[model samples]
Target: MRYDWTPLWRSTIGFDRLFDVLDEVQRTADETYPPYNIERVDENRFQISVALAGFSSYEVALTVEQNVLTLEGRKGEKDEKTFLHRGISTRSFKRQFTLADHVEVKGARFENGLLLIELQREIPEAMKPRRIAITGAGPGKVSQIEAKAA
Candidate 1:
């Protein structure tokens, strides 16, 4: 079945660039060569784990540029391998996870052939949603509540 996303653009303003970026990410994320998992740990915490079975710490490189997390793995030729019939493939793989603004990468670790990435939401004060307090017409004009707390 074919799907059209043009209708979504009608009500949106100043979000054309964001939709373009999403399109690119969807196009590039189709190749599931290396499997991954994304899970929410808590209210403001998240984790992303990627399976790097045959890759060692030295063979993989991780980087967080701006809000994009990139994982690059390239396997070098093994000098001591003496395999008669090699079945396990040691191919290069690269994966990218685009992060939202104020979503910070806390830490990353390798354990049990899985690379775990820890993330925490750091919502900025100005970007957070705020609610305006209402009052009686003669008693109080208005009040402002902390937007970040919400």
Candidate 2:
């Protein structure tokens, strides 16, 4: 299935990335392997936790390229063991996450069968909001009394 974004493109400017994100989301809608959570730690900090119950840190790989974060888990060969009711999954899985602009992966850690990825958005100083001082219309536009108050 495909989505037509012609109207959105015509009405908005500089939102190409938003459309791309939407497309990626639609393509991966059926993915359910390695359930995860996205939590906002603060205004600019975030954490992504993926449940990898039976996988060790060495069995999982995390990579970030361009603006996409990919997580892959490959289970190692297990010793022959017979289980009457096998439930835990040991299958390999791959997950991808599209990151926004200026969002960087701070770090990653595996704890308690969960893989946690930290993210932080660091806006450049030039891109940050600033107060612009407004001056009089012209050099001589200020009233005499107002100028004396300077």
Candidate 3:
């Protein structure tokens, strides 16, 4: 199915990136392999965990480029054996995630058949909000000073 974002494009300003992301998401297929979870650890921290039961850490790869995080997994060759009832799947899969501005991947670890990726939003000190001190005079005093200058 396709989506029409023409109306949104006309009404919003400086949101081209947002529209682009939405378009990209719509064009991609809905993949369910290697389930994952996104959790908010704190106000600016997040964690993503993926279930990789049969795959080892060496079989999986993670890459971040131009704000896009990609995960790829390739199962190793199995021994020659007959399976009467195979339940576990060792299929390879690829996943992609788009990161927002100022968000960075801190690290990733594989433990107990799960791959955990950590992310943190680190806004520069200059971009963070800060309070400005109000000093000198009230509106009346400022108006008197302006009048004297006039």
Candidate 4:
């Protein structure tokens, strides 16, 4: 499916990235080089696991640019020995995930042929809900409406 964002694109400002992301997602919908999965560990935590069979940790590169997490895998020199029927793939692949505001990458680990990426969403202190201290006007302080009514 495709969407036309002509109206929104013309009037909005600073939303080109969002529109571009949507378009890119549609364009890359058929790209399934390296399988992956995303899971929400908690309200503020997330994990992404990518299946990279036959690829070591040194072959994969993880980077975060703005709110996008990019994972690029580059296999080193191939084995000299030939296989009768090779099945396992160790090809180069690049995958990206768009992160929400305040979300950041915590850490990552490679285990059992899976690259596990940890994410945490840390809202700033000012953005969090805070209780405001209400203060009294002062001693004997009254409104003009009270005097007018009397």
Candidate 5:
């Protein structure tokens, strides 16, 4: 089914970039050359796995720009060889994931034809909200109320 995104624009402000990114994400998601999966490992950790059967870690490139995570792969050049039929795909592909603020990429490793990307969430202490304690009635309470009511 098709969705109209105009309503989002009319109801919200300062979301132009968000709409642009969402459009890009939808366009790229329709492609089916390479398949991937995103799994939440823990409360503060995540793992992104992509099926890279014929691709190697050297051919894969991982980059983080702004809040977007991008992965690109390029197969090495091969000498021309005569073949009756070719079934496996060797073309390069690119995938991207939009990351939230304060999310960090810990590292990436490849094994058994699977590319695994690890991510961690590091929240700043100052950004976290804290509760303020309410003190008991003080000596100035009576005078404070009388002066205000006056």
Candidate 6:
């Protein structure tokens, strides 16, 4: 399936980045390598686990840029050895995940041949919702402020 974003691009302003992200996702939608899982631990916490049976911590790299998390894995030099049947896939691969605003990577760890990434949404203090105060006067009274010309 395909989509036409020309109309959206012409109708919206300041959404170029969003359209670009959508295009990128569409381009990589068919790439399924190094199986992974995305789990929501809680309302503000998320975890991404990638299965890398023959990969080690030293062979993988994680980076985040422009709200996008990229995972790359590259195995070390191969040793000269004969294998009766090669099964484990230690191939190099790259995967990317787009995170929402305020979502930041907390940490990552490799255990039991699986790479786990931790993420948390930390909204800035100024961006959080605030309560507004309302003042009212009685039916017969009206509140007014006296101002002096400066």
Which number leads on TM-score? 2
RMSD, one per candidate, in order: 9.5, 6.3, 3.5, 5.0, 4.2, 5.3
Range of the 10 consecutive residues with the lowest summed lDDT in candidate 5 = 141-150
Candidate 4 lDDT, tens digit per residue, 1-150?
A: 888988898899999879988888898899898999999999999999999999988899999998989999998997898799988878888988888889999999988989999999999998999999989688798856545545
Q: Which should have the higher TM-score, number 3 or number 4?
A: 3
Whole-model lDDT, model 6: 0.91
Each candidate's clash count:
0, 0, 0, 0, 0, 0
- Consecutive 10-residue window with the lowest summed lDDT within model 3: 141-150
The C-alpha stretches of model 4 lying farther than 4 A from their native spots are 6-21, 130-150
lDDT per residue for candidate 5 within 60-98, as digits (tens), equals 899999989999999998849887987667789987888
Estimated TM-score for each candidate: 0.74, 0.84, 0.82, 0.74, 0.73, 0.77
Question: Model 3: residues >4 Å from true position, as ranges?
Answer: 14-17, 132-137, 142-150
Residue 143 alpha-carbon offset, candidate 5, angstroms: 10
lDDT digits (tens) for residues 24-141 of candidate 1: 6667756786888999999889999988888888998999999899999999876596889975667898888888778898998999989999999988889889998985556566
Question: Residue 37: error of model 1 in Å?
Answer: 0.5
Candidate 1: TM-score?
0.74
Any runs in candidate 6 off by more than 4 Å, and if so which?
6-22, 135-150
What is the lDDT of every predicted structure here? 0.84, 0.91, 0.90, 0.91, 0.85, 0.91
In model 1, where do residues sit more than 4 Å from their true spots? 1-4, 13-22, 79-87, 135-150
- Cα-based lDDT at residue 125, candidate 2: 96
Clashes of 1: 0
